[model samples]
Target: MVTPTLALLHTSPVHVPVFEGLRDQDHPGFALRHLVHEDLLARARAEGPEAVADDIQELLVRTVAEGAGVVLCTCSTIGAVAEARAAAVGVPLVRVDRPMAAEAVAAGRSVAVVATLESTLGPTRVLVEEEAARAGRPVDVTTVLVEGAWERFEAGDREGHTRLIVDAVDALEGVDSVVLAQASMADAADRATLPVPVVSSPRPGLRAAVLRCAEGVKS
Candidate 1:
């Protein structure tokens, strides 16, 4: 039986509370189920995306099979892998970065995809370009990996991670919009005082997931 709950697949434990807060603020009483597999990202980082493809596919299929009408992949590193299994999973699925990428491409011709991990950069950049193509908006996508930021994030220095990301955003000179590749970087969006818009995944992605669940949309 398909439930009304919105299922979220994450690569980090941090997103549990983050999305919980967003849901609490935006959609009180909305049912949510989160599944985190940090090892998928770690192995992908050490090896490559292919290293975790099977794991991501299985996890995604399992998430939907467990009665999730809608599933959202919150990690950009393995987002494409998860989305690829959507057809086989047979449900409304969303990659967190897609909505943010679409917004970034629409905001300007030059979109900068910022990530703390190098593995996240390529997928995110491609996602931005894909969104641009879908919107018929030509975009110059640039991938920027903020050095040393991931260390801070992994070390549990949340403030340091946000500070580095915010600094990176502030340092960017010529960009139509900045897309935060990982949902963990959402805090930096508010911390950034850039002239150009700073896009983050959690808000728009969760909103899209909630809407999908409400309308029973299949994507």
Candidate 2:
């Protein structure tokens, strides 16, 4: 039987396809379960960020217990909480941006994080700062939120959203390279607007998880 590899997708419905893309890879058998963050996000936005951590912890435990060989959260915004949950779950819980952030820190001294959501940008900035600090490099971090991209994405305008995000990223004045804060934004990395390197989370995390899952199944 194929082991289940649960993917707790973020609040954005847009991430569904991105996770689908990850599963589409020609790896051995695996199953993905998407747990939307919409409700959590709505509550956090309406109420506050205080409650989402508990919600994530609860969801992480539930998903892992459902025979999930490993759990992965697709949102970069909740890295710290996700890390904590992963530790609590006592199973592999891959935070989407951890692998990518590690790569970015190794590549250069200055990093630019391109994200549309304000919530995501904050966590991503912290991750970059922490990574650079550990690397002992003088890091310059810049965050650019793609104006109106998320709204257009929800309206089912993929092309328009892509264009808007690419435009916003292009507008980021300076940096060594840019990291797409969300997996859904990976497509933007292919665009020619970014003269520097573009790092993406989904691919790296997917590859790592897939390899680890395969190892687990073998043992």
Candidate 3:
């Protein structure tokens, strides 16, 4: 049965609380839970993408059984695995980009995908292309990876994290909009004052999932 709320199946530890913050405001009915991926992500980086997919599959199977309405994976590194897990489950599973990418396409014909993690770029590109196709619009998606930002966040340096993202995004010469790949990156958006629109997963993803649940209830 489809519940009135959706569960954010987090892939990274940082994403867990970020989504919780969203529920505090925009989505009170939504809940967030996570599966461990630090070790799993490390293994995938050392091994290959297939290895990551296998671990994600196990986590999704367990999370789905726990009565989750939708499984939204937070990390873009394992997006391919996230898609596979979605296919494996009978419920709606959402990747973080599905909404942001769509928003990017809607915002402008050119979109810049900004991420501090190199691992997230591949999936971000795939998501941009997919969303563009669905919108029947051609878009230019540029991916930029900023180093040390993620480390700063891990070390509890919020100011450092904010500075790094603003500086990196400032370098992008011309883009209609910017889409931040991870939930941690959302904090940087408030600090950035760019000529283009800034899109992040936490807001758009939660809004989409909540609306999906709402629509299901009305149906």
User: What ranges in model 1 sit over 4 Å off?
Assistant: 1-3, 217-219
**What lDDT tens digits, residue by residue, belong to model 2 across residues 1-219?**
465565654777777767776678744355667777777766655665555888878877777777777777777766667777669768677777877887787777778888877778878888888878877877778778888887887788888878887887777765777888877778787883767778888888777776767777777
Which candidate should be chosen as best, given lDDT against the real structure?
1
Q: What's the residue-level lDDT of 37 in candidate 3?
A: 60
Per-residue CA lDDT of candidate 1, range 152-219, in tens?
99999999999999999999988989999999999999889999999999999999889889877443
Query: What are the candidates' C-alpha RMSDs?
Result: 1.9, 2.4, 2.2
lDDT, candidate 3, 125-217, per-residue tens:
888988899989998888898889988987989789979999988777789989888777888787788878788887887777777766767
Task: Please give each candidate's TM-score.
Answer: 0.95, 0.86, 0.89
Please state the error at residue 43 of candidate 2 in Å.
2.4
Model 3, TM vs. native: 0.89
The C-alpha stretches of model 3 lying farther than 4 A from their native spots are: 1-5, 29-31, 215-219
